[model samples]
Target: MDFKLTDEQVKLRKEFYDVCKDLEKRKPHGFAGLESIYDTDEGWEYHLYCAREYAKKGWISIGWPPEYGGKGTIGDKVFFAEARGYYDLPGIDIFGPEMLAPTLLGVGNEELNKRFLPGIASGEVQWCELWSEPNAGSDLASLTTSAVRKGNEYIINGQKIWSTGAHRAHWAFALVRTDPHAPKKQMGITFILFDMRTPGVTVKPLYYMDRAHVYNEVFLDDVHVPVENVVGQENEGWRVTQLLAGFERSSLGAIMMMLRQLEELVRYCNETKVGGKLLAHDPLIRNRLAQMACEIEALRCLGYRIADAQERNEMAGFEASGVHILASELQERLSWLGADILGPYGQVKRSRWSPFDGWYEKWYQQSFVLFIAMGTNEIQRNIISWYGLGLPRMK
Candidate 1:
C-alpha cells in the first residue's frame, strides 16, 4: 500500500517542522541524558519547565478533545508525521501524549478523560506506565499486583519496576488484578490511573550501568484509587495493555533521532585518526557505516508503513512487533559502533560548559539501556512468534 500524504497533510507537517526547527538549539539533552538527570526533585522540575515551554510554543497538542482536554480534533496521519518530525528536532519525551492519548480517546470515561487529558496535553501533568514487575517483565499476565474493591475505592498493594519517568511523574496508568480467580490470567485485570502523591506510594530510583537514574522501582502499599479512575471495563486491563504495547512498538524507530546519531558517528570517524589515517577512510569502518546507513533507510520507510496501518485502525499487533525487532537490533549495532569509534575517549564524561560536551561518550555507555527497556528484543521475538508465526507456547 502506497501511504502517501495529501498536499494539506504535507503542509500541516511542514508547519509542525517550522515550529520544531530550533529543537537542537533548545537543549542538548535527548532521551538518554534527560533520564540521567531526573534524580532530584529540582531536576524533575526543570524538566517540567522545559516541557511547558514546548507546549506553550504550540509544539504540544493541548487543544485535542474536550473529553480528554483536547479540542476533539481528528488527525492521525498528521500526528504520525509530526511525531517523526518532532523527534528530528529537539523533542521532549512525547510518549505520554502519543501512546496514552489514543487509548484515552478510545476508552476513557468523559469525566476521567476531561480531567487528565487536558493537563497531559498541556504538559502540566506527566504520566508513567506501571505495567512490568521483576517477576512479570515479559510475561505481563503473570503480574501478582492486586487491587481489591473497598466500597468506591480499590486498595492497591504491589511493586512495579522499570517505570520510566515515574520518579517525576504526576500520575501513572497501571494494571492490577481485580478478579484473580478468573479462568485466564489476561481476563481479570483492569487498567487504572493513580496520583503519585497519594499516600502509600513510594518511588525509588534505579540507576543504570552508565550512572544515570532513568528507571525506577515503585511500591504501592494500601493505596486507595477511586473507582472512577479505571479505564474501560473491569477485568479488561490486559487488552488495554496489549493495545498500548502495540503502540509502543509501532513507534520503535523514526529517521530523525537515528539520523542525528549517525551524523555524530560520521563526524567522530572523520576527526579521530586510526593508524594516522581518518577512521572514516578505513575500509572496514566505511563498510560498517554504509551498512548502518542502508538499515536506517529501511527503518524509516518501515515506520511510515506501520503508521499507515495504524491510521486505518487496523489490527497492528504483528506489524508493530516487526518494527520493534528491527529497531532494537539496529540500535544495538549502532551503539556498539559508536563506542568502538570513540575508543578511550568514549568512556569519559566531558564538561558541558567546557567544549564538545561528550555526547558520543555518554551515548556509548547509555544506549544499551534502550534494548533492555521498552520490551526487550527477546520479548519482541516472542510476540512475533506467537502472533505472526503462530508458534505454540513452550510446555
Candidate 2:
C-alpha cells in the first residue's frame, strides 16, 4: 500500500488538524485524559462544545454512508481520528460513533438505522456500553442480566458495573439474556438499546483512584424497552457483540494520543537536566524512547491496514485483536517509561511540582484500564492464537 495521501486527503487532513489546533487553544486547563469528559462539569461542557463544533462541520459523520449524512471515506475517518488523538480532543463520543454506529450500519434494521444514525451524526446523543457485570466481565457470556419479551416491549433487569460515562450518557447499548434455557451460554444473549432515563434505570459513580468519576455502576430494575430496539435477531446478539468488538479494538485515537505524549516527553528530556546531564543524552533513556517510537509507528501502520480492510467491507478479526493487544500494552509501557523518567515528580498530581500538569500521574493510574477494558489482553491473546495462528481451542 502506498502510504502517501491523495491530494484530497491531504487537504482534509490539514483542515482537521487546523480546526483541532484552534480547539486545543480554547480547551480547559488540565483537560488531559478521556475521563475529564465526565470527571468535571467544565470538562463535560468543553466536550459538548467540541462535539457541536464537529457536528456542524459533519466531521462526526465523515465515515458513515452518504445516505446517512456521511460525506467521506474511511481514510477521512482515520485522519479525523489522528487529529483528535494528537490534540486530545473530546468532541466525539467513543461509544456512539466509534463503536455502536458501525455495528448498527452493519447489522441493524433499516428503521433502526434511520432512527438512530441522525442523533449520533448530529452529536446530540451520547451513549454508553452496558455489557460488563460484577460477575461477567472477561467471561461476558456468563452474564445474568435478563430481558424478557412481553408483547411489543422487553422488561430488562440486572446490574452493569464499570460502565464508562453511564451517569452522563443519554442512551445505552447493552447485552442481556433473552433465553436462559438455550443449550449454549452465548446462544441466549440479545443486544438492545434504551433511554437512560427509563423509569427503572439508575446510575451511581465508581470513582477511580484519582477520584475521577468516569466509570459507573448502572442498575436496571424492570426497565421497559420496545422490542424494535433489538438489533438483529433476539438470542443471536453474541454475533452483534462480536462484530462491535472488532470496532472497539482498532483505537487509532489512542495511538495518536500516545504519539503526542511521546513528543512531549522527548522535549522534556532535551530541555531538562538531571545531576548536570541532559536526560535526552542518557544512553538508557534514548534507547527506551527509540524503542517506543518504533513500536508506535508499527502500530499506526497496523491501524491504517485495518481501516483499509474496513473500507473494503472485510472483517479483520484476529488483526483487530492484535491491534488491541499492541495498543493496550504499548500504552501501559509508555506510561511506565514516563513515570520512570519523571521519577518522584511523576507521583505528584495537579500540584506546583507536577510535570505536564500531572498528566503522567493520571496516565500512570489509568493506563492499566485499557488492558482490562474491551476484553482483557489475555483474552485478546487467546483470540490471536486461535484465529490468527489457526490453533485449536484448549477445550
Strongest candidate by TM-score: 2
Evaluate residue 394 in candidate 1 and report its C-alpha lDDT on the 0 to 100 scale.
Answer: 74
TM-scores of the models, in the given order? 0.86, 0.97
Q: Candidate 1: minimum summed lDDT over ten consecutive residues — where?
A: 68-77
lDDT of each: 0.70, 0.90
Q: Which parts of model 2 are misplaced by more than 4 Å? A: 248-250
Local accuracy of candidate 2 as per-residue lDDT tens digits, 214-269: 99999999999999999999999999988775563337988999999999999999
- Among these predictions, the greatest lDDT belongs to 2
Candidate 2, backbone clash total: 0
**lDDT value, candidate 2, whole model:** 0.90
